[model samples]
Target: MRDTASPAPERRGGHPVATRAAARLDRLPPSRWHRRITLVVGIGAFFDLYEIFLGGVLAAVLAAQWNLGHTARSWVIAAGFLGMFAGANVLSVLADRLGRRRMFLVNLGAYSLFSLASAFAPNLSWLLALRFLAGVGLGAELVLVDTYLAEFLPRAVRGRYLAYAYTFGFVGVPVAALLGARLVAGHQLLGLDGWRWLLIAGALGAGFLQVMRRQLPESPRWLVVQGRDAEARRIVAGIEERVAAETGQTLPSVPEAENVPERRVPLGEMFRGDYRRRTLMWWVFQVLQTVGYYGFGSLAPVVLTAKGYTVTDSLLYAALGYCGYPIGSALSIPLIDRIERRTLIIAAALGIAACGLAFGFAAAPWAIVAFGFLLTVCSNVFSNAFHVYQTEIFPTGLRSSAIGIAYALSRLTSAVLPFVALTVLTDLGAAVVFAGSAVLMVLLCLDVALLGPRSTGRSLERI
Candidate 1:
């Protein structure tokens, strides 16, 4: 018989001669290197949420300063989603072609510069333009981070790790909201508008994160795919060594037999093969969840105010609602691995529907706050589960593209949501808006329950 013990086919560089090097990705306990990488990537994601949340908080300020009508204000709020639509589809493809780390850096730098420019916008039109541009970078940054995190972690802990990674991003929302409330509530700074100062401050923070991210290494898995096996080995070994040093546990060697094929499937292939049902299921799931999520999230204060609360009361209630995000995200970390993703998604959708309807009908401020908090908690739970689910459904070859396309659809729907909200609330009231959202959520839950695949602990390749 041929030598059964021969070394697996080595790729270029000193890496073991393995066919599917990515499948054999080294797994180790969390180390300083892993923590540092998570921090850098998580901070980048934080800025992305900060930029988006800041816009919502500043909308009222912009309306007063710019003399913008409700329609015009909705336009400004919706513009960023337009940019997100373009960026997710375009840059995601480029990310796969270039590299996850490279695209992430480019997006961070671009968004930071644009966000700073937005602080000085002379008019509403200019501000909208700048916000749109900044959103392009924001969109790409979100997709690339998910791609990078999925590739960096092992399959065993991927669900929990990704959920934890996303918690950092959600944490930024409340931070932005609290800070924006302080900045825009009254005090001006050195002849600059407080809202403008807020945007500028966010830009500066983003730039700081960009510098830190520069120190992060590219995903070793990506390097292996590019035929840089020796470099991949070095990077993985470094991670293993750091984890060993930190956790006092020896890292296990990767199994040679677990290597996968390296062929890159085209983006179109996602809709044709084993991925077809998942693609359709996620597309519907994302669209409905976003309409429910952003519809309430972007307009929380406005909705509260519409229900006869004072501005201060509305802001306070909205703050309480936002607090549920981090709580829900944290709660999902342990549950994501324990429960079926589809089951959690379906339950979350139903909860969002029920709680949203209750909040819509409640007149008392405390009642609305309580119901809104429940709705927000459920919405975020669904968000965390879906985020983990979407990235896990695709192989490394098309992970970014598939996720980006689904995310783009969500943004595209969100781009139209503000106008939809404005029209419906103006004609039918907040109850109708919430009631309709409930219908959508219920339908989506049914779709996911009936058609969605189970992907809780499966590998991307197996999915």
Candidate 2:
């Protein structure tokens, strides 16, 4: 239970709430619970990614089941993103005001229930409406998970830990793709369409996890902001004890009232000075990168089929593309803390451009597969690196809101790209589509590299 007796803990040394939380976490060991928290959060994130990728996986199946054209399928896939944009932007402010843990649980429950409803949709319109509603929950869940992890983990291990969690989380993409392929590749079950079964299974799986997540504690830092230092101390002490027993090292001393001065952050301060610039840069980067990234991945099968591959071959090829997610996640671990985030992001973006061009122009099937894999690898690298970068840039007081705003823009841009890609590629050809994406990547990379700060290895307060 949250402590109700003490005055809210003061923000230490004028640092943001998250930075203070990060500092406190530095005192603990990297223990089983620590790893478990990371894993559980990743699991939750996996379901989030599952929902995002499921739309793409179901598109081909939906087309066949409904006898719809490419345009209609594109709209269905885009609807989720449209819903996500609204959720991220609207709920993020509430996260700051109401509290992270509260909002997190609400988002999870909301999405899970709506997703379950989607499984029973009688027609395309019903399915699309349910998907959009579920997407709002999904959008908030993604932002909250990132914020929660960043707050709870120590800075020393934040990059690598987050990388591992995200890598494993994204492994859900391949899981969803492979499962959808196998299930839908055959006859329907229980007289319900195979595609409907896929939706039901995913919804039920996510709902189960949300139920389990109630065991999770709220962020101690949020408690501190509400003037519950004693409660915050109790939670931190438990974590420290567990970590010490697991790692066989004494936990470092937490700074006490005698050792450090107190500070507080007013909500309106984010709009002043350098923070405003940083916020704008993140928003722009997210919007452009998402468009380039999702536009390619969401349409991978369609693009491949357009190049003359059979349906089985296209699905297999798309699976190969999905594999790049985990690989990219794993590869980013070592580089995340070692390299400048700005540099890594720029390189990843340029690599995406090169791979996109290569994929568009490749005539041979093997060459297309190879280039598609490379593109996904680079795209994930850019994505994971930015995920860490953006969260680390803001203070705890506004972290969720900032991330939510930026993430919302990304979803908005992504929502439009599928329709745009379908329309443009129809008349302009795959080469032009790929080439246009390449140009966007290059320009966005330059903008971020030149304007964005180097965030790796820095304390959140310093950032």
Leading candidate by lDDT: 2
lDDT of each: 0.75, 0.77
Clashing pairs in 1: 8-17, 9-17, 10-17
Residues 100-179, model 1: lDDT tens digits: 87888788888889889998999888988998888888887778877888777766777777777777888877776676
lDDT tens per residue, model 2, 87-160: 99888768876777788778878888888898889888998899999889888777887888877887777888
160 in model 2: Cα distance from truth in Å?
0.5
RMSD of each: 3.5, 3.8
User: Using Cα atoms with residue i matched to residue i, what is each candidate's TM-score against the true structure?
Assistant: 0.92, 0.92
Residue-level lDDT for 37 in candidate 2: 83
Looking at model 1, which ten-residue stretch has the lowest summed lDDT? 1-10
